[model samples]
Target: MNREDFWEIVERSRAEVGDTRDAASAAAVARHVVARLTALGPSTAVEFQHFYEALNEESYRWDLWAAAYLMRSGCSDDGFDYFRGWLVAQGRVVWEQAVADPDSLAAVGVDPDDDMVDCEAMVAAAGDAHATSTGDREAFWAALEQTEGDDEPAAPADPAGEDFDFDDDEQMRARLPRLAAVYRPVQ
Candidate 1:
């Protein structure tokens, strides 16, 4: 599935998730996405996995990580992974903005009091959907490999772009002035 299709699924899930975008609500979104994927059938569910991984790969950047670090006060490697999942749950507009200009995220708004900017369920949604639809997740992966070869997006050795010390307050403020103004002070 292309990004447009992926976003449609995500947004549809968000609609199911209703008005709140908090972590508590994210599980429902994942459930909705799984139901939607199951309805779409197994092949598209597998395609959704590839597209989800590609979007995650596309978003694996130092700048975005910095944004995550600031939003959550500190971000570990796995924390960033979950952050990417949450970012995906935010739908195309927020995800694209975070990738293109993470500072733009300040305008998108988040609850500073709510630090659960992680959606573990979303990370597992496609696989769960595949299993729910096909009864065996490995069978779907094998089918994908047989039909199109292994084209899963790989995680980079490190995030793309210049690395920096996220714990340094000065660097955080300078790198993400708007976000620092919003979340850093709150933290």
Candidate 2:
């Protein structure tokens, strides 16, 4: 598959994962990934592992793929370290890139800050929110949370509060601005 096709498959697979997925559902997602990879071509397990690892940089579901690849390739520790390092590096790159081109932030409705916040912290918080969220709203919140800021402990959810449904893509997009606003760096 071409790059567009590959991403389409990845996006479709991501859409399949739900808030309360069971083992079987998880397996189905895995099967979809494996099928997509297989269609791409045969590679050494190690090569496939690396492909998945790199893909995870863009696709969150590929995080598990990277872990599985590392395990199957006998590089679990290396995989973990590599993934962590890659994320740390990515966080920095994103921050620097944003700093270099302040206008880019406008695409996401964020203003450039002379004193940018901690990018890593912002990314981690976004990632955490994404992990706990469901559907497109989850993706939106995650994307919004990607910014420069100090890392902070996530506030505990109120037990008495009603949980929001995150299944609709439109709802997610609508909430993106709010989520992004939370991570805006203080100038």
Highest lDDT: which candidate? 1
TM-score of 2: 0.24
Off by over 4 Å in 2: 1-3, 15-24, 43-50, 56-187
Give the Cα lDDT of each candidate: 0.84, 0.33
Q: Each model's TM-score, in the order given?
A: 0.90, 0.24
Q: What is the lDDT of candidate 2?
A: 0.33
**Per-residue lDDT for 1-187 in model 2, tens only?**
3445434544455456532122233334444444554444432212333333344343232222222122223224334333332222223333233333322223432223311211222123223333333324355333434431356333333312223333333432343333223333224
- Candidate 2 residue pairs in backbone clash: 117-149, 118-149
Tens-place lDDT digits, model 1, residues 1-187: 7878989999999987775357777777888898999899888888888788788889989999999988877889888988888888888888898899999988866887778888888888888888888899787778556655465444688889989998888898899989988987745
Judging by TM-score against the true structure, name the best candidate: 1
* Candidate 2 total steric clashes: 2
lDDT of 2 at 172: 28
